[model samples]
Every structure is written in C-alpha cells, then in structure tokens.
Target: MSDIGPESAAGKRTLRRALLATRNGLTADDVRESAVALAARTLALPEVAGARTVAAYVSVGAEPGTLALLDALRARGVRVLLPALLPDNDLDWGEYAGEGSLARVRHGGRTALSEPAGERLGPDAVTGADVVLLPGLAVDGRGLRLGRGGGSYDRVLARLERAGTRPALLVLLYDGEVVAHVPGEPHDRPVDAVVTPSGTRRFR
Candidate 1:
C-alpha cells in the first residue's frame, strides 16, 4: 500500500478485501438493523428529499442494505430506478415498483443479484435522475468510493457525464467502512456524499 492511499492501485485492492471481509462477518440481524438506520440517515439527505427521480439498487449478501431505502424512497413518491446487468457487464435500467417488482438473476459463477423485473428502459434512462444511489464497499473522507471493481456503475457515471447531467451521486456503506483515504484515479469521480448507518458525509 502506498503511504497515501489515493492513486495507489495496490492500496485499493488491499483495502477492498479488508472491507469486504468485515462486511461478510456481519450477522443477519446486524444487516437488518443497519439497513433501518441507513434508510433513515439517507432519506434525510436534502438531495434525496428533493429528488423526483432516483436511480438506486438492491443490496445482496453482506452489502449495506438498500431494500428498505428503496421502499422508503418510493413511498415518498420518488421514481426509483434499478439496474439489470447485461452480458457485457453494462447495465440496463428499470423502475422499482416494490418488493414484488424485483426478480433474482444469477450470473454465471457470480452472486445472484436482485434486479427490477419491469420494463427494460435504455441505459441512458439514468440521465433523468435527480439523485443516483451507488453501492460500494467503502468510501474515503474525500468521497472517493471503493466499489466491487465490476465497472458497472463506472459506466453509469460515464453515461451521466456524457449526457451533461450532474445529479447528486451518493454511496451507501456501513459506518466503519468510512475510511481516512481510498485509492483512485483522475477518471474516478468522487461522489457527492456517503450515507452510513450513523450519519452522512459530504465532499467536494
């Protein structure tokens, strides 16, 4: 790991593994309780409170939960969008209707993902969102998110940029996953904020 976490490739992999291991150790009850708190903390964000359309996702395995947050956002009349992974690892968007509207999809040799089962909206559909909720393993003080390295959300962010849309980008994570620093590149866009179970952290 580099003395400074940012810009060090090895630092990201090392940190990501550690964070994921900690998450995998969480109990089911722990995940449930944290999800409730995360929902409350994230729902209170001014950007989310004012958003008409929010692009979000479903959490799987040990990731910080998003189902409760998704439901809460929908209850507030926000049009929530979820991603369905394509074969090439790109994403396709679909609206979140409710719990019943989700379907489990298992990619070969990968953890099954719960995605929206409704109409298949084109990928560019995310450009209409007022807020975009990202799923991540950890985030640093400067709002640099450490993702799963799947490059899916990276594509989403690039699409948003190409469309000249600058919606508030947010990541959901466990409280302890908020770290002092994270490795990143110039092309790696820092998020606007990170919502943890305890509170929210905003960055430039």
Candidate 2:
C-alpha cells in the first residue's frame, strides 16, 4: 500500500479547507452561475460537442457544482445520463432530463436521479460514449483522479481500455481543486481533461 500517512490526512484537510473557502466566498447563486458558465465552456469543447451521448454523475455532499450543467446539456438536446449505483456499487447509466424527469432512486449510499425509459447501455457504454464527464473527490495537474474511495470508475474505465475506446474522460472540479500532485493508488484512473470554473484544460 502507499504511504497512507499524515500527508494523506493533511492533503484531505487542505482539500476540505479549500472547498469551505470556496463555499464561504461565493453565494449559492454565484456557484450556480459559475457552474453554468463552466458547463457551457465544456460543451464548446470539440470532444463534448461531438459526443452523441454523455454520462455524468450527480453532485453530492460538498462537490463543486453540476446541477446547472445538467440543465444546460438537456437544453442543448444532448443525451445525458446519471449513474445509478447498484447494490455492489457498480454503476448503471440512466437519462436525466431535469429534476422533473427524474424519479427518486438511491442505492449503495449513492442518491440517483433515474429515468425508467432511459436506455441502459452495456459495459461497452464507456467505449461507445463520445465523451464522459467523470466525477471525483480530487484531481491533480497530471489528471490523476481520486474518487470517493471507491474503485467503481476505475474499474469501468479499465473495461473501456481493454476494449480500446478513446472516449474523452474529463474531470470536473472547482477552481483550486486542481493540485500539483495527489496520492494515487495503482488502480486510480487519470482523466483526459479537467474542467474548472475558469476553463477546460486538455491534460491527456
């Protein structure tokens, strides 16, 4: 195993502090607006624009922002899917048309907005996707992603890799969540892009 020591604890604390500071400095309205703007910028990316379908995760806890982005994607006539976490913490994709279109659903400690009519793509869904906006707990300059202590995304993305897919996996975060380096396990995944409040950066 990696160090998993005080540095890790300290890094997590720094991340928490950063999130708190961001929240404290910005009102709810500001965060919402910034999220919308950032979403718009993401859609402008060639990878995002060309994607026929995209899967994104619903924001939970103190995660930066995503609601407005979901709405923006829907407004643009894009097919958007949110993760439906299964009992084993495996993920299934479901369409999201907005809060109204979503039915209340939760599993594996993860809350989900589900669309019964939404098509459930196979594990190959990752390979078929034109772009994927990944969710993570933290990210670094090299695009390494630290998920919520779960190996789900890594496993899924690994499936895509074996099948030889090039879907752009992009990590979304708040402004300062992008760090110089972060502790990464061997199974941790790296994203192709990172989208922040200010802009979208191509790292892969």
Instruction: Give the winner by TM-score.
Output: 1
TM-score of 1: 0.94
Q: How does residue 52 of candidate 2 score in lDDT? A: 76
For residues 1-204, write the lDDT of model 1, one tens digit per residue. Answer: 324544476778899889988988999999999999999998888898999999999999988899999999999999999999999999999999999999999999999999999999999999999999998988887788889888899899999999999999999989899898888766678899998888888897
lDDT of 2 by residue, 21-98 (tens): 665676777667767877778878887777777778666545667777777777888888776665565777767777
User: For candidate 1, which ten residues in a row score worst on lDDT?
Assistant: 1-10
Clash pairs (backbone) in predicted model 2: none
Question: What's the distance in Å from true for residue 71, model 2?
Answer: 2.9
Each prediction's total of clashing residue pairs, residues at least 3 apart in sequence or on different chains, is 0, 0
- Global local distance difference test of model 2: 0.71
Instruction: Point out where model 2 deviates above 4 Å.
Output: 1-26, 108-119
Task: Please report the TM-score between candidate 2 and the true structure.
Answer: 0.80
Q: What is the C-alpha lDDT of each candidate?
A: 0.90, 0.71
